[model samples]
Target chain A: MTDRPLDPAVLTPDQARALFRAGLSVPTAGWCAGRTQANLIAVPREHAYDFLLFAQRNPKPCPVLDVTEPGAVSTRVFAGDLRTDLPAYVVYEHGEPVAEVADATEYWRDDLVAFLIGCSFTFENALLGAGVPVRHIEQGRNVPMYRTSRPCRRAGAIGGPLVVSMRPIPAEQVADAVRVTARYPSVHGAPVHVGDPSELGIADLDAPDFGDPVDVRLGEVPVFWACGVTPQAAVMASRPKFAIGHAPGHMAITDARDCDYIVP
Target chain B: MTDRPLDPAVLTPDQARALFRAGLSVPTAGWCAGRTQANLIAVPREHAYDFLLFAQRNPKPCPVLDVTEPGAVSTRVFAGDLRTDLPAYVVYEHGEPVAEVADATEYWRDDLVAFLIGCSFTFENALLGAGVPVRHIEQGRNVPMYRTSRPCRRAGAIGGPLVVSMRPIPAEQVADAVRVTARYPSVHGAPVHVGDPSELGIADLDAPDFGDPVDVRLGEVPVFWACGVTPQAAVMASRPKFAIGHAPGHMAITDARDCDYIVP
Candidate 1:
């Protein structure tokens, strides 16, 4: 309720979520240090099966961390209310953006099934911990993402192309980046493509489809990891009756630690 | 098909499936040595959302490898027909077993959705490669499975207690078994319990609820891994209108290699 800015890094996940619930709208790039963040997507129960199948088929691009039962307001990993906990939400009607709102209670439905998917932001900390430079975080810009030539396997009524986020890492540390991120399989594990953007049908590295593009630098290689934007892309392509998702970079922070997902 | 008994160890997955498709019914143990095997469960589309939610909530006991679309007969990892490829099937009506048959074609419904859950059988080969002794395979008996006291997180209409398969490992080799099996998360991951059976609310380890009992040596420790029987146990407890599952010990062999699921 005060007029001063809050420091995201030092706040607890509950504190950060409380601020968002109180109508503070901002991208959650860095919040609650080690807690995991998630991409949100809520759809009608009628379309839940198709969406679940879509995620099961396309795991790299859509690693599902948690799923809520119909009309449920919370999941196992997230304790806050789904209707008002996230900083922002995009309401979609027949796959078209109908409204962007801070609170989604007015548009929430009793039969909605919300899915909490793994976000790349969860692995960025691990990357930095391993001494791999993340260009976007260093430049204070959003990560660059692109729509690829790869088409995700269609499930029932859902389908779309794979979307990838780009991070320019030094050529010498690219393998280290892969090793670090591969440990967290639930969060966009490992880079899908390295070295060439043309192989993924991405042109003009400076012009990204979503988010701000960062410098590739002289000796850095463009490393691409599957992005969380994939399900939204699928929502647009499939044209479902109704859908809801977290606004770009405005994620739902969960209580799970980054190490919880790390595998052997 | 000839009446002569065939050696299963050297056969390809497709060859093994062909034998099953031609009415050869037997447990898939040791068949197609290096290939992955799965537990099959098919349910009506009306109940799929609940089932998918159940698997998501209880991942250890129900590690989903592949899920087929409603009315579809195959999955990405499974190329054979769901109706006739598997060796044997148990058809259920209102959760009660109505019939056991060689082919499920007559009981197959267009609205059915099939799920390929990861079985402990897939990890047994890796355990052997790591020098961990497998008593069940050595004794030519099935792995002993029991119902634990811990209840699984309930999803809509599905709820049940956790089911686990027990394996006896030498005290020195228990760590190696855990390390080796931990690499394959898709195959029920690591051990849920290491030593005490009484802690899990089981009175006697020798009297198992499913599969045959195996001996535990003087210096060996009993290790428990989440079993694939958990989902079927849920179905039987919840009593859905219709369900189909693979007969005990009979499994569906997949084309995926054991190394494909290994993590760093």
Candidate 2:
């Protein structure tokens, strides 16, 4: 067996699929550098409308890239085979994580529809290239995420509190951060709240509901952007009978480039 | 009773509602200048997901501005009471136009949801302001719309051929027409096709599927953009038990400005 790390530059979207098919890479984030990667979530067809409506209501946190037809695995917008393209998958039953697997071919059902949602990694690269520091990346830690007091707009059976990711920015560089990220609205565009964590019901800076807590020094303010995890939280709260999503950091990489999502 | 024509410039979104409430303006198009005017459609709650998915599938034609809570009359994003704010509404039953009512108050149900979609009039004004002559406006007729051979991708039970509106532009001005309209993606951004009508299965310029046909003069090519009427066509073809939409030329004016829809 070849033990070399997968080179994203050398792989095609199809080759990436082959790698995932072989159980090579477990997390899909750093695998395909320039291509768009999506956060995948599959739910039973009975709850498809409710999940879709939930995504629409909370667009900032869940900008839907494409939703596949019921019982169909291929999506027209995001090119890739949903069954084997992703390197990892997480199956949830009654909102609780049951298993982590490489391929969902066995768990897949005829009544399941997949949803591809925009991921912040696409825009984060843009920010880094533009000289904006992504603190979590610099510290080699997962971005801190918190459950906010602010509730997402309810739609049918889907309703829950908003989940936000926090990044500390120097006072002088705050505007630059906003300008860089604002261009990609499809990936949780612009910061929802800039200054106060207290306003979001996050009392202690060190304690986060998910991910690692980063340092916020003297001159930095805790800037918050809606996180992709909001939908997962909503799904968990709604407690749908069956759902599947990417394991925390793993995602489905698409043929689309990050620049394609930029507005103007 | 005062018989003065409604002056959009002087009215607030609430005042406009009061005026519409008092039966002062039957057609909402010219009443609220500068504010975003929307295409209103109400569907039974059971059919809400299909219609919403249809809108998502055909966004250029059905650019959704906001969707109201189920059974709720007021829109959280657009503003005011949907029941009496609109000057007029057309009720359709079993795919046929049943009544043109001044108010949907009586027909309003606890299981219905209102959807506000982007209207092309928002961008038409910008085009005219930029010196692009709109043919139908000059001739005092409705803008010409045609049914195309191109089919929209299906979602749930909604699927049908695309419908587009044609505006004749001088060959030299096509680029300017594109740049100006492309700024407003929410309101059918950019042209779907240009130059040849026959390519879209349009046989004669004189006959159109909906609205009046306009003349295309020498050195001008008919530019086509997805029309807001596409959803209505799908609804009719699908034959939902009941549906409601604004009468053509009549729209729902909102608190949002035309510039608000522009991404740049």
Top candidate on TM-score is: 1
Tens digit per residue, CA lDDT, model 1, A1-264: 323255677888898889899998877776777999998999998999899888888889888999987899998899999899898999999989899999999999999999998999898888888999877777867778888889998988999999899999999999999999998888888989998999999988899887788998899999999988888889988999999998867889998887888886
Flag clash pairs in model 1.
A264-B264
* Candidate 2 backbone overlaps, count: 0
What lDDT does the true structure give each of the candidates? Answer: 0.87, 0.79
lDDT (Cα, 0-100) at A150 in candidate 1: 90
Q: Could you say which candidate leads in lDDT? A: 1
TM-score of each: 0.96, 0.86
**Cα distance off (Å), candidate 1, residue B28:** 1.8
Q: Candidate 1: deviation at residue B126, Å?
A: 1.3
Task: Record all residue pairs in model 2 with backbone atoms less than 3 Å apart, i.e. clashing.
Answer: none
Task: List candidate 1 segments past 4 Å from native.
Answer: A1-6, B1-6
Candidate 2 lDDT over B1-264, as tens digits, reads 235354565676777777777775444434556677788888898888788888877777888888888887777656688877777777888778788776788878888888898877788778888899888867756677788888887767777788888999999999999989988888888899998999999988789887688889999989999887777777767778888887655677788888887764
What is candidate 2's lDDT per residue for A1-264, written digit by digit as tens?
A: 225364654566777777777876454444566777788889997888778878877888888888888888878756667877787787888888788788888888889988888877777778778787778867756678899999998777777889898889888888988888787877787889999899999998799887788899889988998877787777777778888887655678887888988875
Q: DockQ (Cα-based) per candidate?
A: 0.77, 0.41
